[model samples]
Target: MHHTRLFDSYICLDPSMWWDNQALLKETKRALETRRFHGTSLYLGIANTADEGMDVTRVLTDTTTATLHMRSALQLQRYFEHNQQNGLKYRGKYYQDDSHMSVPFIAEYEALRFLFGAERK
Candidate 1:
């Protein structure tokens, strides 16, 4: 999204935030802070992979590799929510019943609907 104006919309489902120490998250933060995506749209679909008893607050403090995935994604979700000045049409959906392995189909369907203004029937 930073390098291209070709694609006006983006859909990221259950990103692999464990890669390169979550460089994607860091880069996105910087981009959102510095760049303006006025005509672009971004949708982030977060999966619930938490183990028993681990909520958002609890997993946020955990530095383990297992929890980093969801934590990083959630951070991006919250960031997009709070920082809406960039004129980027952004939506973040948290699927509490979905796991990492089971989010793509639903996320893609919903994302497409959002991008195209399709109503659920």
Candidate 2:
């Protein structure tokens, strides 16, 4: 989720701007590449949002993190399926009947449940 937003702001919106800041990009990439988690790390991405901009290939190959992406079929810009096909774990929750604004309420709840269903807390 954070990655997607950063990608959109730093890459998609202005690639030249991002390229000009090579040092920043290198630092960020290094940080992302070296991150280690003791327990489990989970990512949750939502459709009609910044989720589509995420680099799934880099994420899957660079780290052994697990991600659960959800989206609505009704949202024309949603591209979670394509990224999922490229190797990201996807939990299909096609909110075909729901509008973009309504998806977050349901999707966020589903994300929390998916992430912590096994927890005693």
Candidate 3:
């Protein structure tokens, strides 16, 4: 599972899931720029073939926006693969096995409730 925490929002994504990464990135950028997704921070937990997990966490403040935007752009570009002889195929199949490869969107407000042991808000 890939985890990203942006401000008050947390996203748990499966890398093998399929979606238009470019579109998502584009929308996310727009959201960030417009302050729609402000206070959003994200952590990406990448599991390697060696069975080791790497945590990639970033705080989505104005300072890191440019870097995150660049990474998102690259990820969007790599989401699809072109076989020299074949056509295009999504590169996110690894996370899609068993229909479990998808991102679960969680609001920060809800996370705060759970973190603080408060009643559901």
On TM-score, the leading prediction is: 1
Instruction: List, residue by residue over 11-115, the lDDT tens digit for candidate 1.
Output: 989887667987878888788877788889888999998897888888789888779889888888987887798889988899988898899989999999998
TM-scores of the candidates are 0.90, 0.31, 0.27
Decide which is better by lDDT, 1 or 2.
Answer: 1
Best by lDDT: 1
In model 1, what are the clashing residue pairs, if there are any? Answer: none
lDDT tens per residue, model 3, 11-36? 32333222463466555434333432
lDDT of 1 at 99: 90
TM-score for candidate 3: 0.27
RMSD of each: 1.7, 13.1, 15.6
Candidate 2 lDDT trough over 10 residues, lowest sum? 8-17
Determine the backbone clash count of candidate 3: 12
Full-model lDDT for every candidate: 0.85, 0.35, 0.31
Whole-model lDDT, model 1: 0.85
**lDDT at position 72, candidate 2:** 16
lDDT of 2 by residue, 1-121 (tens): 2353222111011111123334444453344444432233333333332244444343334322222121111121133333332333334354433334766676566656555564355
Q: Give the lowest summed-lDDT range of ten residues in model 3.
A: 88-97
A best-first ranking of the candidates according to their TM-score comes to 1, 2, 3
